[model samples]
Structures are given as C-alpha cells and as structure tokens.
Target chain A: MQALFGQLLVGLINGSFYALLSLGLAIIFGLLNVVNFAHGAQYMMGAFAAWMAATYLGVGYFWALLLVPAAMGLVGVAVERLLLRRLYGLDNLYGLLLTFGLTLIAEGLFHQAYGNSGSTYPVPAALRGGVNLGFMYLPLYRAWVVVVSVVVCAASWFVIERTKLGAYLRAGTENPRLLQAFGVNVPLMFTLTYGFGVALAAFAGVMAAPVYQVTPLMGSSVIMVVFAVVVIGGMGSIAGSIFTGIGIGLVEGLTRYLYPEASSVVVFVVMALVLLVRPAGLFGRQR
Target chain B: MSRIPRVACCLAALLAAPTLAADKVSDGVVKIGVLTDMTGYYSDLAGPGSVLAARMAIEDFGGKVLGKPVQLVSADHQLKADVASNTARKWFDQEQVDVIADLVSSSTAGAVMPVAAEKKRITLLSGPGTTAFTGEKCTAYNVHWTYNNWALANGTGREVVRQGGDTWYFVTADYIFGRSLEEDTTKVVKAAGGKVLGFARHPSPGTTDFSSYLLQAQSSGAKIVGLANAGADTVNCIKQANEFGVTPKQSLAGLLVFITDVHSLGLDTAKGMYLTTAFYWDMNDETRKWSERFFAKHKKMPTMVQAGVYSSVMHYLKAVQAAGTDDADAVMAKMKATPVNDFFAKNARIGPDGLLRHDMYLARVKAPGASKKPWDYYEIVKTIPAAEAFPTVEQQACPLAKSASPAVMKK
Candidate 1:
C-alpha cells in the first residue's frame, strides 16, 4: 500500500516532465500547426547546456535554470526564422522532416563529443535530500519539480487563454491576413510562440538534469512518451495535454505496481485505445 | 628414366607443401570483426574501446597470424538480435572474417553465436555475460571470456550475504542478460542462506527513471537491494537510490558493474558499494603498463570487456599460429590446450564448454576521499580463484562437457 503511494508520487514527478514537454508541443501545434520533432533534441541541449555551464563556466544549477531556457528560446527563434519559417508555407510534414533531420544531426554531434555513458549533474545544495514522508521518502527536488511545473502550466494557461496579447496571437493563427490588416506582424507572433514553446521544454530539461543522466539520448527516450501524451491529450489542447500528461504518469505508476513488465508499454496501450475510441482525442475538436 | 622420375617426385612435394601452407589461411588474409553496440547503453563499456583493444592485440601479435596478414572490421549491431545475426552472416559468408569478437549485448551474442557455429568460424566473446553461452548454448567454435553471471553472482552475492545483507530485493533489467544475472545471484544468495524478499523487473536498453523500482525495494525492507543490471541502468539505479535516500538505509549489490559506470557516477555516490569484475587496470605492474597504453589511446581506462577483447584476440591469434591453420576445430583445440597469460587473466584456460575460467575480483568502490587519482575507484577485497569462481565440468550443463571423454576434458 505504501509502495503504491510512492509509485504514484514518482509517477507525478515523471508526469511533470511530460506535462512540460507536451505543453510546448501543444502550444506549437496550436499556434503553428507543425509537430516539432526536434523538441527532444532541444530538450537535450538544455540539459547539456546546464552541465557545460557548470563544468566550463563555473555557473551553478540555479543560474543555468535562468539562462538556458532563454538561450534555447533564442535558438528556437533562429530555427523558426531560418529553417522552420521556410517550411511554414509547405505541408506540415516538411517542417517535421526538417526538424527530424536537425534532431539527428544534433544527436550525432553530441554523441561523437560525449559517449553514451553520459555525465552527472549534482542536485542543487538546497534540494539535495529527501523528506521522510510517511508513505515514502520524497525528494524535495521532485516536490519542487511538480510544484514548479504546475505553476508554469497555470501561468502559461493564464497568458494564452485569458490575456490581450494571447487574444492577438490566437487571432493571428485563426486568420493571419485579418490580423495583418489590424497592423500586427503575424509571422513574428508565430516565431515567438515557437520560441516560448521551446523555452518551456528547456525549462523541463534543466529540471530533469539533476534527476536523470544528462545523456545525448535522454530526449529521445522521453520524447516518444511525450508524443503519446500529446496524441492522447488532443494535438493542440493545452489543458488537455497538461492533465493527460499527469494522468498518464499516474496510470503508468499504477501499472508499475500491478504489472511491472507492461509498465513501459501501458502508455501506448492507452494511446491506442484512446485513438480507437476517439480519433480526435478526448479533448481535441474536429477540424 | 630414373632421374626423370626423381625430379618429378621433388616437384610434386614442393608444390604440395606451398599449397598446404596457403590452404592454412583460408582467404589468405585473417579477418576479425567486432560486432558491438556502437551507440547504445553498453557502448561505452564495449563499443569502440573493444575495437581498439582488438587492434592492440593485432599489433602486439606483430599484425600477422599463421604467415597471413591480419585485418580488422567492425559494425554496430545496434543491440538487436536480427542485426547482429545478419552482420555475422555477412561477415562469415562473404567478408571471410575468421572470428567475430566483442558481442556486448547478450541477445546479440546469442544471435551471432549460432550463425558463427553454422559457418564454422571462431567467435571470441568479451562483452556479453550470460552463462548460457557456456552452458546450454555452448558452441564448439566460440569462447566466452571476461566474466559470466555465475561468477559475478558467487563473488558479490556471497560476500554481501555474509555481511548480514541476508534479506534481499532485486531491481533487475528485463532482458536475457539481466534475467540470467538475477537468476544466478538469487541462487548464490539462497546458497548463502539469504532470503530474497522481492524483486522489481524494469525494462532495459532505455529506462531513464528507476525511482519507482527503488521505492518498491525500499518498502520491501530488504537489507540489500541487488541491482541485476549493467552500464547506465546500474548507474541510474544507484543515483536514484541516493536521491530517494534508499542507499544509506538499504545497501545495494551491483551484480554486474563496469569501471566505466563508477567513473560516470563518480566516487561520491558510488562509494562503499561492492561489485565483482574480471579485470581492473590498476591491479599490478603489468596491468598498469598495458592499461596506461590503452588509456593513452582511448582517453579512458578500458573496462573488463575491453581488456578481455585484447586478451581473447591475442590468445586466438596465438592458437591460430600454433595450430598452423585458421580451421575452427584445430584452433579450438589449441586454444583449449593453451593457457591465457595476460594482463586481463593470469594463466586461465578455456574449458571444454568454451568458457575461459579466469579469476574474478571482488572490489569495493573506494570513497571519494580514498580515491587519490582519476580512475582509482576500486579497493580490491578478495580474489576468487578460477577453480572456485567458475562452474566445474560436472556442474556445467553443456552437452559438449557431458559427451567429451575424460582424456579430452583433462586440463
């Protein structure tokens, strides 16, 4: 019974990562309508950037959390302007293919530089240890991750769903020519949305560096699961992606206790079932 | 007419001798292929480093064997059984690779071994640790070097159990290699009168988070949590164990760990853990000399798998040279008869079951304060001799051992 609670909490922690990453995918798809295949690679760069900062520049984890996301967001903007922008006028598959190619190139370069064994990033001094919760020993850092993830999700939701700038952004996505006539730069809005989405992924990566081995392949490992989250949550449903990500984490945790062997595939099984029953996803609306 | 007949006889003898020598080397160039996981979980332990080790062996062997120039080729098996088998088949059928080495993943090795056996080519396995390679699946044309599950189980399990970690829980990787390791360690733990409280089997090759599994082990209240995994999996389990505060309360028994894992984890988190290995680079003067050279080239110390690659390759090349042929049967006999004396193993002999019975070391990870230099990780606890470390012929389940007569099995 205690083990179940512990697993559930661990699941929530994992869900936080899913929630952050899928939220980015959801926002990008909602605004830009292109699946960011390189989101995983971008997340990996976030983790690597944190490690490199600490190793080479003597910057600590807190400073990295502040800097890496902004830096990666700028990278996202450049990618949007230089490469992703060209694909905007083409089919969505073109953008996916280009991003996928970029992912491979980035992963290959990192792999060559750092072998697959990977490097370790120490947990911050402030949140280094765990508290003895009656049900389990919960690491303070994990609790921090869940709390911060929820806050970020809520803040982003407030900004996008209930703000004037967000209204302009949604209008730009819905009717770009109309918004352009209103004297707004629609393409720049698209670029910033992509950048902000990428920044969210980097934030998750920085949070994850202390927990997981900062390996070149870390992003790909979780990216597929996050994609499953996005699909199950409905491609562009922000709240749906956030809730579904955490819910799947809970279900995956329960599966770990009930049937450990199927834990890895249980998410996919749910995704398949969801797809069969609701092709547009539970929260997704038909075009 | 008599002088003409004698001249013709000499001419036939001279031609036949050259033909026989040429036939000794089948393709006129001895080729060795290293089929390994080039960019997966086990790559650091046995990927390019294993290739470098094979190259070093070839160089040390004067780059020639049985009067034929030796060549090397390598491919990434990608840790897939089908990929490994296909590559092995291609290497054997077309490339004329006489021996395949450094099959790191158990499934890949299992897949390739049969293909090698069918093609009648030698396989020198230095990476995979499944005991089945020398037991039920033993092939006449292969050698299982480095270490196996049984040796690791006996060395680490027995020691941990003796130290009052008598109640255990296992967090095992779900794969052939991981399953065999858990099974073997369970036996050793039970033999030492330890109780296995429970185990949580996690998916392998790409399990990033092990906190759930560690939580299960923690709640089980076992004195020790045996990690029946390797490479990154083991490292992650230990790391998370620290994060969840499971380590100081309940100890961990790493059934199969490489030096690279400890290096990756660093001494701070990996300190005071007990594990077993086939070789350590800082063991002796000779080991230091060879390993220094290896480190100079590899930029990191060689793992047991990498060290085993060099030893096994050198031994195989020598057997080919001594037998005067690359024929599988003759080389196997010679390799079995010869003793492997190298930095990796001291005077170890290949058993009839194709297992190189070598001494395994039980080492504890040195604490951060104790480690004075880079890669100085292990504090050697004890040496389990080859005779006691490996299974005897009577104990092994290989049919070859059962069928071979006492005269042939005699060492």
Candidate 2:
C-alpha cells in the first residue's frame, strides 16, 4: 500500500512535465492552427541553454529560470517571423514539416557537439536533498516542480480564458480579418502567442535540467507521450490537457507498479481506446 | 603441332593456379566495417572512438596486409536490429568488407552475426556485453571481444556480496542484454549466499525518469540495488538514486558500466560505487602509452571497447598477414591458435565458443577528494584472473565446445 502511494506520487511528478509540455502544444494548436512539431527540440534547446548559461557564464539555476525562457522566446519570435509566418496561409502539413526539419537540424547540431552521454546540471544547493515522507522520500525539488507547474498552468489558463486579451486572441483565431478590421494586430498577436507557448516549454526545460541529464535527445523521448496526452484531452482544450496529463501520469504510474514492462505503452493504449470510443476526443467539440 | 602446344599451355596454366591462390587478398584490398551506434545512447562508448581505434590499428600495422592497402568503412546502425542486419548484409555481399567490428548494441550484434556467418566474413565484437553471443548464439565467424555479462556479474556481484551486501534488488532495463545481466548477477548473488528480494524492470532506450523505479527498489528494503543496464541508462539511474537518497542507504552495483558513464556522472555522485571492467587506460606504462595516443586523437581516454577494437583489429591484421590470405576460415584458425598479447591483454586467447578470455579488473569509484586528476575515477580493487573471470569452455552451451575440456589456453 505504501509502495502504491509512492508510485502515485512519482507519477504525479512525471505528470507535471507532461502537463507543462502538452499545455504548450495545446495553446499553439488552439490559436495558431499549426501543430508545432519542433516543440520537443525547442524544449531540448531550453535545457541546453540552461546548461550553457551555467557552464559558460556562471549563471545559476534561479537566474536561468527567468532568462532562458525570455531568450528562447526571442528565438521563437524570430522563427515565427522568418519561417513560420510564410507558411501560415498554406497547408498545416507545411508548418509541421518545416518544424520537423528544424527539430532534426537542431538535434543533429547538438549531437555533433556533445556525444550522447550527456552533460550534468547539478541540483541547486537550496533544494538538493529530499524529505522523508511516511510513504516515500520526496525530493524537495520535485515538490517545487509540481507546485510551480500547477501555478504556471493555472495562470496561463486564467489569462487565456478570462482576460480581454485572451478574448481578442480567441477572436483572431475565429476570424482574423474580422479582428483585424476592429483595429487589432492579429499577426503580431499570433507571433507573441507562439513565443509565449515556446517560453512555457523553455520554463519546463529549466525545471527538468536538474532532474534529468541535459541531452540533445531528451525532448524527443517525452514529446511522443506528451502528444498522446494532448490528443486524449482533445487538441486545444487547455484545461482538458492539464487534467488528462496528470490523469495519464497517475495511470502510467499505476501501470509501472503493476506491470513495469508495459508502462511505456500504456499511454498509447489509452489513446487508442479513447479514440475508438470518441473520435473527437473527450473534451473536443465536434467540428 | 597445334595439339602439342595446347597441352603444354594447359599444363602451364594449371601450375600457375596454385601460386595465384596462395596470397589471394580478396578484391585486391582488405576492408573492415565498423557498425556501431553513431548517434544514439551507446555512441559515446563505441561510436566514433571505435572507428578511430580501428584506424590507429591499421596505421600501426604499416597500413598494408598481404601487399594490399587496408581500408576502413563505418555506418550508424542506429541501435536497431534490422538496420544492423541490412548494413552487415550489404557490407558482406556488395562492399567486400572482410570483417565487421564494434557492434555495440546486443540486439544489433545478434542480428548481424548470422549475416556475417552466411557470407563467410569475420566479426570482431568489442561491445555488446551479452554472454548469449558465446552460449546459445555462438557463431564460428565471430569473436566476442572486450567483455561479457558473466565476467561482470561475477566480478562485481560476488565482491559486493562478500563485503556484506547480501540482499539484492534490481532495477533492470527490459531488453535481452539487461535481462541477461540481471539473471547472471542473480546467480552470482545467490551463489554467494545472498537472497534477492525483488526487482523492477523498466523499458529501454527511452526512459528518462527513473524515480518511479528507484522508489520501488527503495521500498523493497534490499541492501543493494543492482543496476542491470549500461551506458546512459546506468548514468541516469545513478544520478536519480543519489537524488532520492537511495545511495547512502541501499548501495548500487553498476553491473555494466563504462568509463564514459563514470566520466559523465563525475566523482562526487559516482564515488564509492563498484564496477567491473575489461581494461582501464591508466593501469600501467604500456596501457598509458597506447591510451595517451588514443586520447590525443579522440580527445578523451579510450573506453575498454575502444581499446579492444584497436587490439582485436591489430590481431586480425597480424593473423591475415600470417595466413597470407583474407580467407575467413584461415584467418579464424590463425586468430584462435595464436595467443593475444597487447596493452589491453597480456596473454588472452579466444575460446572455442568464440569468447576471448582475459583478466577483468574489479574497481571502486574514487571519492572526489581521493581523485587527484581528471579521468582518475576508479581505484583498482583487485585483478581478477582470467580463469575465474570468464565462464569455462565446458560451461558454455555452444555445440562447437562439446569436445573441449575446462582448461585455460596459453601461448
């Protein structure tokens, strides 16, 4: 029983990552109508950015949490203006292909520079150890990850769902020409939205740098699972992805406890079942 | 007069055929292909470094064999069995590669060995530390070099158990190589009068977070958590183990670790761990000399797999020279008959089951304070002799080893 509780807690910690990444995918797909295939590579770049900042400039983790996202957000903005902007009126597949190509290039460049053994990013001195809970020993850093992820997810949710800027943002997605006639800059809004979503991925990357080895391929490993989480929650459903990400995380944790070999495939199994039962997804509107 | 001349011509052609066949280097050149993980998890241990080592061996051997210029080719198998088999098939069938070397992933080695055997080419494996290569899956055209799971399990498992880590639990990678390591270590642990409590098996090649598995191992209350994985996977597990505080309580035995892993983990976290290795670069004068040369090229010290690649390639080239031909059978006979002596091994010889029996070192990771220089992570605990290090020939399940007795081979 204690073991099961411990697995659930660990599952929730992993779910935090899923929630943050899928949330970014959801926001981009919701507003931009383009599936950002390079989000994983961007996330990996985020971790690398943090490691480089620490290694080269002696900037610690706390400063990286603020600076990396802003820096990666600028990169995202440049990508949007230079590359993604031209592909907007074209087919969605073009966007995916371009981003996928970007992913391969980024991954290849990093792989050449750092062979896949990966570099180490030490946990900060403040949150280095764990507290002995009755059921498990929970690292303080993990608890911080969960708390911060929930706060970020909730704050982003409130901004997009409740604010007037969000209303204009959603209005642009509905009809860009209509919103443009109303004295709104729709194109610029989309660029910032993409940048903001990318920054979110970078934020998760900074959080992840301490826990996992900062490697070029780390983003690719979890990107597929995060996509499954987004699909299960319905593509663009903000709250749905957050809840489903955590829910799938718990289920994956339980599977690891029961049958560890099948844990990796468990998320896809759920997606298969969910799609079969509801082709539009649980939270998706019937388009 | 025409019939007499034709008979004389036929006799003269027949006499020249024997001389022509004596020094037949295939395709007028000898090519060696290194099929390894060039971009994946195992790339650090055996990818580009293996290629450099093979090239160094060729250069050291005067870059010629049997009056033919030696050549080298390499491809990334991507750690997929199908990719490995297809590349091996192409190299043997079309490229005229005399031997394939450095198959790091176990599944890749398993896939390519049959193709090499079918095409009558030799394979010198410096990575892929699974004993099944010499046991049920042994091939006549293959030589299992560097190390194997049995030697690792015996070297680290028995030593830890004797030091009072009796109860064991494993966090294993769910693959053939990982499962074999776990099973071999379990036998060693039980043989040393230790009881295994339980285990948790995780998926391979993609698992980034080991917290869930480590939690399970922690709750089992076993005295030791044996990590039955290698390369990056082992490095990740050890890092998370320290974070979760599982290290100070239940010690970890890295069943299959490489120098790259220790270098990645650094001494602060990886200190005080026990592992078994086939070779260490800083062991002595000869090893240091060769490894320093390798370091100048690779920009890092050579792992055992890389060193073994150089040794095996040099030995293969010498055997080819001795036999005066690149024929697979003749070279195999020469390699098996001659004892191997180099900086990597003093006097190791290939057994009938295709395993190269050499002494393994039991090493403990040096603490940060104890480590005086970079890459000086391991303090050699003991030198395990070749006899006790590997499985005896009679114990292996290869059909070719049916007639051989349990005796050590010496030059």
Best by TM-score: 2
Q: In candidate 2, what fraction of native interface contacts survive? A: 0.83
Model 1 bad stretches (over 4 Å):
B1-23
Candidate 1 similarity to native, TM-score: 0.96
Best by DockQ: 2
Give Cα distance to truth, residue A52, candidate 2, Å: 1.3
Candidate 1 residue lDDT tens string, A207-258: 9999998888999999999999999999988888999999999999999988
What C-alpha lDDT do the candidate models reach, one value each? 0.92, 0.91
Expressed as tens digits, the lDDT of each residue in B1-411 for candidate 1 is 899989999999998985576448887988999999998889899999999999999999999986789999999999999999999999999999999998998999999999999999999999998999999999889899999999999999999999999999999989999999999999998999999998899988879999999999999999999999998889889899999999798999888889999888888988999988999999999999999999999999999999999999999899899988888888889999999997888889899999999899999999999988989999999999999899886677999888888887885
Q: Give me the runs in candidate 2 sitting further than 4 Å from their true place.
A: B1-22, B403-411
Query: What DockQ does candidate 2 have relative to the true complex?
Result: 0.86
Q: Count the backbone clashes (under 3 Å) in each candidate.
A: 0, 0
Docking class of 1: high
Candidate 2 global Cα RMSD: 2.0
